[model samples]
Target: MPEYRAPLADFEFLLHDWLNVSEHYAQIGKDDIDADLVNEIITQGARFAESEVAPINQIGDQQGCTLKDGKVTTAEGFPQAYQSYIENGWNAMLGSEEYGGQELPYSVAIPVHEMLVSANVSWRLVCGLTESAVLALEKHGSDELKETYLPNLISGEWTGTMNLTEPQAGSDLSLLTSKAEANDDGSYKISGTKIFISGGDHEWTDNIIHLVLARLPDAPAGVKGISLFLVPKMLPDANGEFTIENDLSVGSIEHKMGLHGCPTCVMNFDGAKGWLIGAPHSGLACMFTMMNDARFQVGLQGTGIAEASYQGALTYAKERLQSRAPQGVQQPDEKADAIIHLPDVRRMLLTQKALTEGSRALGLLYAKQVDIVRFGTEEEQAKAESIVAYLTPITKSFFTDMGQEVSQHGVQIFGGHGYIQEWGMEQLIRDSRITQLYEGTNGIQALDLISRKLVRDGGRMLQNTAALFSDMINAIQNEADKNMALEIQQQWLAGSESLMSGDAFDTASRAYDYMQFCAYSLLAICWLSMKDRAAQTGNDQLASSKAKTCDFYIKRLYPRALMHKAALGDSGEDLAALSLEDF
Candidate 1:
C-alpha cells in the first residue's frame, strides 16, 4: 500500500490562484478571507483530517457497522472522531455566519472538505451530508426553519439526511409513494417508506433532520405531484426544542459493498410529524436544492478516492523495491531502484495527481460560484447562478465517474499488494464505485448535460459558455497563453454548434465528458495564472506543482476528451439495435 500525503501545494494553488476566492469575499461585501487565512485554515483542516480521521479509515472498513435489532452502532472510534470533527469548526465551514458558521467561501470549503473525503470517505460522509443539508435549508428554507435547525447542523450537534428513494423509486421520482397529509396548523404528517437513504438514520447527533419527498392527498399525479418536507427523528415543539421522539425510525440499515462506516438506512415514517419545506407539491424542486450540493459532494468522492489512492501510490513508488531502472545505470548502490524512476509508474502517479487536483480546482471554482450567487451584486449574482446551474451536473458526474477510474488504476499500480485489505488500495477501488451510482448515475448526468441542460432555453446556457470561453481565450491569446486557451475555446464551440445543428447526438457528452476535459483545462489555466500571480518577485512551490500538472493535463488528459465527444449522438436507436429476442 502507498502512503498518504496531503496535496497541499496543489490545493493552495487552486484556492489562491484559479478561483481567486478572496475576490469572492470582496464581491459579497466582506473581508473575512485572504491568502494567509486561507492557508492557515487549509493547513489546520489537513492536519485534522490526517491526524484524527485517516487512521480510522481502514479500521472502519474492517469493523464496518453493527446493526442490532434496530440501532446501528458504527465502528469503534467513529463517535469520538465525529465529536472531534465537531469540536473543531470543520463542520461549519459553509454555514451562515448567523448560525455560527465561519461563512467562508465554498472555495475554501471545497478543498478542505476534499481532504476529509480523501483521508476517510466512510467517516466523512456523515459530516459531509450534514453540511449539505445546512446549505440547502439556508438557501430555500424560511427564517424560522433556518433558526430551528441551522445552528445545530452547523455545529454538528445534529446531523441531516436526504430521503428521496424508496424500494421502487430510485431513479423515477414518479414512482415514489411517500404520503404527506397537510395539517390545519400549516404542517403535515409524513408517512411513507424510504430505502437506501444515506445518513438517514445515524445516532451521531441529538436528532436527525430528514428532507423527504412525498405527496399530498389532493396533489396532482406523477412528477408534478411530488413535494418536499422536513421530517425529524424527534419532533420539536413550539419552543423550538426536540422534547419528543418523532416516529421517524429506521426499518433497517442496508449492508453494502462500500461506505460501510456511513449507515445506509431504510427509514420508515409512520405518520411522522412534518413541515412543508418550500411549496406544496414542489418538493422535488426543493429537494433538488440539496441534491445539487450532494451531486458535487459525490464528485469530490471521486477526487477524494483518487487522492487517497495517489497517496498510497506515491508512498509505494518511493519505497517499494522493483527492477532496475530502464536507464541502465541508476541506483547501483541499492537492492533495486524506486519505481518512481520508471516512466509508467510515474505516469500512473502523475495521472492521479493531474486528475484528482484538476477535479479539485474545478470543484472549488464551482463552489465559489455558489458563494458568489448567494452574496454577490445583482448582476454578479445572476451570472453566478447561471453558471452554477450550468455546471452542477458536470461537476457531480465527471469527478465521481473519473475518480472510480483513477482508483482502479491506483489499485493496479500497487500490483498484488493493492488487492489486500492491508493496503487500503482495493478499499479505495470498492469505495470509489458508489460515487458514480449515487446523486444520480453518471449516465443520467450525461443525459442531463446533453439533453436537458443543452437544449433548455434554446441553448442559452451554451451561448453563455461560449462567451466565457471566448473571453478567456482572448485574454490568454493576448498574454501568450493562446494555444492552451484556444484548445478549450475550440472544444466549447464545437460542442455548442454540434448540439444546436442536430448533430448533438454525435456530439459526444459535453456535460460530463466535456466537464472532465474542462476540469483539467480550467485548472491548468487557473494553476498557471495563480503561479504567475503568487510570484511577482519570487517562486512559489504551489505554482511549480501547478505548472507540472498543467503541462501533464494539456499534454495528456485534456485532449482525450475528444474520444467521449466522438461517442455522443442524437439517439440511443443504435444502442437499441441489439434485440433481446436476438440474444
Candidate 2:
C-alpha cells in the first residue's frame, strides 16, 4: 500500500511562521485561540488521519462501495473510521459554535482537512460534502431549518450532499427540469433525478441532508426560477424525530474510473419531503453558497492527492535500484545505484515537490482570505471578498491540474510498477482524475475566471490582487527572493493585459491560458512569502528547503506562463473555423 504521513511541520510553518495566523485570530476577537490550541488540534487531527483513515485507504479502493437492493454499502472499515472521525470532533471544526461546533477559522481547519484528504480522499468526501452543506444552511437556510437540522449535521450524527446536476443539466443549471411543488403544510414535495451526486447514498449516517436545486411551480424561467430545497433521506415527524423514510431511492452507484471508495449515486427523488431554503426563484444563488465552498474543498482534494503521490514516488525513487550514476558507480557493492541518482529522476521529483508544495501554500493563502472575510472588519471583509472571488477559480483549476500532473509523475517514476495495481501508484492517477472534471471542469473554471471574475469587475479585483503581490514582494528583504516574485508578477500582469484588451470571443479563447498564468503567478507569490518567512524564523533547514523549491519553481515551472501568454494572442479564429463535418 502507498504510505501517507501528514505534513505536520509544513502546516505549522505555514500557519505560525508564514501567515502569522495567531495575530489574525486575536484581531478577530478569538483571543483564546492561541498557537498551542491550534497546534494541538492539528496534532490530534493528524494522528487520527494517519492511524485510522490511512489504514483503510487501500482496502476501501480494493472493495469499492456496493449497492444491493436499493441500498449502498461502503467499503470495509469505512463506517468505523468515520465513527472515530466524528467522535474525535473533526467534522465540526468549522461549524458554528451555537450549533455545538468548534467554529475554528478556515485557516486552521483547512490544513487538517488536507491531512484527511491525503490519508483517504474517497472517505473524506463524506465529511467534506457535509461541511459544505453546513455552510449553505448557515448562510441561507431559514431559522427554523437551522434550529431543526444544524445541530445533528454539525455533530456528525447526520451527513449531507449537494445535488445540482440532472440527466440533461450538467454545468448549465438553466436546463434543469426538476420540480418542487408546494404543499399546504408549508413544505415542498421535491421530485428530481440528480446524477453525479457525491456521497449521495452512504451508511455512515442515518439521515442524509440533501441541499437540492429544483424549479417551483409558477416560477420564472431559467436559473432565476430554480429554488434550493433541504431534502432528507428520512422525514421528521412533528416531534422532530427522523423515523419515517422519505420518498427517495438510490437508482445506482456510479462505476467510476476512480474514487471507488466514494459512492457517487444516481439519486431518484420521488416527491421527497423538503423545506425551502431561500426564497423561491433564488435557488441558484443559494446553491452558489454551497458550490463555492465545495469548489475550494475540491482544490484541497487536489493538493492532498498531489502530496500523497509525491511521497510515494519519492520513496520508490530512493529504494528502487537502477542504472549507476552518470559520473561513477555510487554504490559499488550493488549492481546499480538507486534511481534517485539519475538527473531525469531528480527533475521529475523536484517538479512534483515544487508544484505540490506551492499549491499547498497557495491553498492556505486562499483560506486565510476566507478567514478575513468571515471575521475581519467591514472594510477588511470587502477587500478580502474581492481577493476570495479572484482566487476561487484559480485554486480549483490550478491545484487539480497540478494534482493530475503530480500523480502521473508518480506513475512514471515507478515505471511499469506504477501501472500495476499492487504498487498503488495507479490508484492515485485514477483518483486525482476526477478532481479536474468535477466541481466544474478545469476548462469551465478558466471561462469563469476570465468572463465573470476578470472581465465583469472592470479589473478592480485584478488591481487588488496585484496590490497583495506587491505587499509580499516588498516584505522580502533578500534580493533573489524579490527578483523571483517580481518576474512572476510581471508575467501575470502582461497576461492579464492581453486578456483584457481582446474582444469577447478572442478573450474567451484564451481564458484557460490566462487562468494558468494567474495560477503560476499566485503560486510564485506564495513560494516567495514562505521563503522569506522561514528565513526570518532562523530555521536553516526550513529556509533552505523553501528557498530551493522557490528557485526550482521560478527557473523551471514559471516558463509555462510564457507559453500560455503567447497562446493568448490566438483569438480562437482557427478553432472556430473548423466545420462540424470536417472530421
Candidate 3:
C-alpha cells in the first residue's frame, strides 16, 4: 500500500478551527506562527512522508537490516531517504533555535511526526530516539556535552539511543549490572551489555551517541546507586569530533513479530569511553528526561497507527463491494455501492475516526502545552508544566492501546484482506503491537497512571483537571449529535478517587477507557475551543468537521469510558485471590 493521504482537512480543523494552537503560540512568543505557516508545514511534511518515506516501509521490513562484521547496514533505500529527510531539515523541525534547529512550535513538529510515522513508523524509530536523546541531553548534560551533542543531534547528523535494559533487567532497572569505572579524567570506562536497544547500531549517521545508565565501582546496590553516562560509538577529541572507535559493538538484533524496519540491537560494551550526563547516582531521573518524551512519542505511535488503520478501513469500506443494504435498499445501484453504505461498517469506521482524531488532537494539544511550559513566562509555565505532567502518561498508554485495538479493527473490517500480508492490513497490526511494549508497556503505563500521575501530589492534579473536563462536558449537544461524551465525563469524575488509589489498576485496564476518557476529553475541549474561533472566522467546513468529530467522539466512541469505569471498580480481592496454584 502507498503511504496514507493524511486527513489534512480534518487535521486543520483540529489545530486551527478546534484547538487553540495559535493561542499557545502567542503564549510562547511565537505569535508570528500563523495558520499559513502551520498549514504549509503540514502539507510539505505530508508530501515528504507519503512520498519519500512510505515507499521504503515494506522494503525495510522485507530486507530488514544486515549485520555483517561490526557495521549495521539498513535495508536498501534507507540511507538515501534518510539523507533526503535530513537535507530537508525534517530532523530539525522542533530543535532549539539557539542551535541550527528551526525551533518551529512543537505544535507543528508533533503533527509532522504523526505524518511521518503514519507513513512509515518503524523506519522512523531512529528519529524518535534521536529526538529523545536531544531532550535528555539538553535538560541535564553539561554545557560541554550540550554544545558538542545538541547541534549534531538536533540536525540528525549524529543519532542517539538510551541504553538501560540488561538481559536480567527489562522493566526492573534495579538489577542492571553495567559498570562505569572512573578514569581520573572526568570520564569513565563503561562496561555493560544492553538488550533491546533501538537504533543501537546503524550506519545512517556519521556517529552514534548513547546515554547509558550504569553503576559506579563503589556504588550501592539497586537503582538509586545507578548513574547516567553519555557514551558515544566513537570517541571525541579536543574539537568534539570523532577520532577513534569506541569499545562498543552490536551483539545481535531481535527478530520481533513486527517493526522489522527498526533494529533493536543487543549492544555489548567493553569499557566504552563514557561521560556522565547528570549528577552521580541520578541516572533514573536523567533517563526520565528521554523516557517521558519517548513515552509520548510512543503514544503518537498509537495515534499514527490508529489513523493509518482507520484510513485503510475507510478506504476499504468505500471501495470493497459487499452484501446489500440491511435496511432494505440503501444502495440500489449495481451489485453494491460499497460497504460504507452499510450502517454496521459505518459504525466501525466512525469509531476509528472518533478515537483516532481525538487522540491526534490530544497530542497536538499537549505539544502546545510543551511550548508554554518550556518558553512561557513564570505564571503560565507553572500551569503548563502541571498540565504536561498530568497528561503525558495518559497520552502514551492510551494512544498505544488505541493503536492496537483500532488496527485490529482495521484488520477485521478487511476480513480476509486484513489477514493476508499482501494487503498490508496485518502489517499495521504487527507494527502497532510494539507501541504498547516499547517505551514502557501499557501495564507499566497503567501503574504510572495510578502512581506518579493520578495519585501523587495528594490528588491535586486529578482534582484540577476535573474543571477542564467539566467545562467541555457542559458544551451543548444538539439534536444532530449521537455520541455519549457527557456520560463519560460523569463516569471518569465519579471514579477519580478510586483512580487515585492503588486500586486504580483494578479501575482501568489495557482497554484504554479511562485513558481514552482523558484523551477524548482533551479532544472534545480542543475541538470546542477551536469551534469558538472558527465560528468567528467564518470557516464552516472546518468547524462542522470539528462538531461532527466531537459528536462522533462522544456518542460513538466515548462510551468506552463506561467500560473503563467498570474496569476500575472490578479490581478487587478476587484478582488478588488467584495464585500460581489456582492457575
Clashes of 2: 0
Residue-wise C-alpha lDDT for candidate 1, range 1-583, written one tens digit per residue: 3445677876766665545667757768767677899899889988988888888888888888766866778887888989988998789888888989987777777878888888889988888888878877887788888898899999999899899988999989999999988778888889999998877765577788898899899889899999888887887678967889887788887888998887888999988888888878888888787888888888888888888888788887788778998987468889889888898988888888877776776677677778877778888777777777777777778788778878887787788888888888999888888998988988787667666667654676666655654554554423555565666666655755566544444434344555554444455554444434544424566546656766776677766765655544334456557799866
Model 3: per-residue lDDT, tens digit, 81-187? 88898889999987888878887877888888998888888778989999889889988999998988899999989999989899999998999999999998989
Candidate 3: which pairs clash?
A: 17-530, 18-530, 483-554, 483-555, 484-554, 484-555, 507-567, 507-568
Candidate 2, lDDT over the whole model: 0.90
What residue pairs clash in candidate 1, if any at all? 2-312, 227-283, 228-283, 505-568, 505-569, 505-570, 506-568, 506-569, 508-568
What is candidate 3's local distance difference test score?
A: 0.79
TM-score of 1: 0.93
Report the number of the highest-TM-score candidate: 2
Give the TM-scores of the predictions, in the order they appear: 0.93, 0.98, 0.92
RMSD of each: 2.7, 1.2, 2.9
lDDT by residue (tens digit), candidate 2, 196-253: 9999998898999999999898988889899999998988778978999999999999
Better of 2 and 3 by lDDT: 2
Q: Going through the candidates in order, what is the number of backbone clashes in each? A: 9, 0, 8
Model 3, which residues run further than 4 Å from truth?
A: 237-240, 330-333, 467-490, 498-549
